[model samples]
Target: MAKSVAVIISILCILAFSGLSQCHEEPEFFVNGQVYCDTCRVRFPTRISQPIKGARVAVECRDRDNGTMTHNAIGMSGDNGEYNLTIKGDFENEICEVVVMKSPIAECAEVMEGLNRARISLTSKNGLLDTHRYANPLGFITSNPLFQCTQVLAELDLSLD
Candidate 1:
């Protein structure tokens, strides 16, 4: 009788420990974002902005204390300018940013000054169960605004007025 009780207790302890580990399991981090071409020469993206396919994007993390690069991952945009990057490992105390590497479209190859990279956090220390982080849309600048952009700008000005 004592032997059976010990066996059952051991199984129960094992099950309890397994459940606790599962509860504390680390979550997978995923970063989802998009890249666009500013056809209207606007610093920000608009409804008329075109998505650039085959654009290269990179997620880089630098050590906050030394400013040295710690982690880097590259991904390419799909036909819809959407990119999903699976970031591995935790980058605690590091400053991470999603940066534009290259644009496949010739007209939208130039990176805008402040829109090239967006900062993001990669640690799960925050009270968020979902590890998915949505980054701001990064965009490339066109050499000249598209012809229709003039009408769009006019409408915008009229609305503001």
Candidate 2:
């Protein structure tokens, strides 16, 4: 009887301390990227590009074979248009992507064609020991080109017309 009581107390103590704090445990994966506004209407970021603040981004993982969604997480961009989303667990055989959901600015509300989603690998089997995975910048298009975009596009050898 005494042995059983001691065992129970030991488990209770372990549960109390371990469950109370998990500060040392590192997350399985972190998805990091930035949201940008394509002011040049060139479908990509340039010198005249603007960082979109308060943009909504999502991490969506789908089954590779069946094409069914397996995991989903949402994150909001900060003042600098940067977002870091924590994704738990390993998805060895899944297709994961970061997609732009919404742009807070009315002028930059339209999704940039071919730049809406950026693919990312979420598997540990890829031999990358780093937990930080970077996704390509996702952007939205502005209704009209910004004033400076004209000269900026020319300097960069790009044209929206």
Give the per-residue lDDT digits (tens) of candidate 2, residues 119-156: 99887779998999999999899998888887887887
CA lDDT of 44 in candidate 2? Answer: 72
In angstroms, the error of model 1 at 119 is: 0.8
**Which whole-number lDDT from 0 to 100 does residue 119 have in model 1?**
93
The per-model lDDT (C-alpha) reads 0.89, 0.90
TM-score of 1: 0.86
Error of 1 at 159 (Å): 9.9
Quick one: best lDDT, which candidate?
2
RMSD after CA superposition, every candidate: 2.9, 6.0
Per-residue C-alpha lDDT of model 1 across residues 1-161, encoded as one tens digit per residue: 99999999999999999999986665568998999999988878777899989899999999999999999999999978999999977787899999999999998999998999999889888677688999999989999888787777776773212
Clashing pairs in 1: none
Question: Which candidate has the top score in TM-score?
Answer: 1
Worst 10 residues of 1 by lDDT: 152-161
